[model samples]
Target: MANYLLIAASSDIGGATARRLRDGGHHVITTARDASVIDPDVVLDATDFDAVDRVVAEAGDLDGIAVFAGSMLLKPAHLISRAQYDETIAASLTTSFAVVRAAGKHLRNGGSVVLSSSAVALAGLSNHDAIAAAKAGVIGLALSAAASYASHGLRVNAVAPGLVQTRLTEGLTSSDMSRKVSEAMHPLGRLGEPEDIARAVEFLLDPANDWITGQVLGVDGGLGALRPRQRV
Candidate 1:
């Protein structure tokens, strides 16, 4: 059985991914900022590089690591406050970097690293300024880290998900009108579930998919690449 680390295990997608890994008979170590939530193996601030390094070091030979630390902010760039932008960047981009850095230093050869990005990072979406920027940084960081660590046999990839039905996104999906509008944006005609993205993360983390690296897997229900057809 392989060993894996999941940062921010309290998040919906993170919890789903952890369950998937454990069900496959792999050893999973989980972390979250809040100890009461999810009762993770570690209470961690994933954006803190020193804390991330310590976790990786203690894990003792990890096969894979995935960072699910992120946030959602739907506000225009012009209206976004300085603190909001900083928080967004720290949550997603900074946390991703911390994981990648730790993985590079500690993960075993041929190990995998998965990061969470967003469809808005690749496709244009209104009122997603702060989050889009942060997730976009994650993509760039993943690609570069993949390149840098390729020589050491480490694989790095990012999963970009579209609108997902989770506690974090309840504000956007709780209303019928908002839900329909969001669903209509995806060519698949539905919002993504946490399991959907979890499956993608599982795929990337599996040793069977070792050939894949430096790739951004879009788990966005066709939202990142396709334009939905007009309804008559």
Candidate 2:
């Protein structure tokens, strides 16, 4: 069984992914800003490299690190101030870098680094500018890390999700029109669930995935390839 350093386990996708790994017999050390909500062995602020290093030291040995700690900010271009945009970027991209750096220190020689991206990385979406840009960078970071860490026997990969029902998407809600439109955009005709992305992550983090690295796998129901206009 693997020992996982799970970041942001309080988030919808993060918590679900943590449970998924645990259900499959992995031990998870989680962290969120609020350590009391859930039992994260230590408190961590992904944006702070020093804090991340401190927590990694506390987690002892880890087989993998899942960087699923992120936030969503939907706003028009003009409305997106520098601070707001910086916050989003820090959460999605900067935190990822911190996690990778920490993993390089705490994870096992053949450990896994799993990060979360969004379909926006490859597609167009309104009000998603900040989040999308950060996620696109995430894809790049994962690949670069994969290359840099190969000699150390570490694997780096990313999973881009589309329209998963989570607190981040509360604005999208359960509207039938939004659901139908979004689902129709995907060739699979459905929105994603937490488990969908979670399973993909688990597969990539599995020891068997040692051969797979520096790849960005889409869990977006084919939105990256299909005609999204049909849904409109």
- State which candidate has the highest lDDT: 1
* Model 2 per-residue lDDT at 25: 86
Q: Which pairs of residues collide in candidate 1?
A: none
Q: Per-model C-alpha lDDT, please?
A: 0.93, 0.84
Model 1 lDDT per residue over 1-232, tens place:
9899999989999999999999999999999999877999999998899999999999998889988999988999999999999999999999999999888888757699999999999999999989999999999999999999999989999999999999999999999999999988998889999999999999999988999999999999899999767665
Pairs in clash, predicted candidate 2: none
Prediction 1 TM-score vs. true: 0.98
Give the per-residue lDDT digits (tens) of candidate 2, residues 12-87: 7788888888898888888888866676766778899999988877877777888887787888778999999999
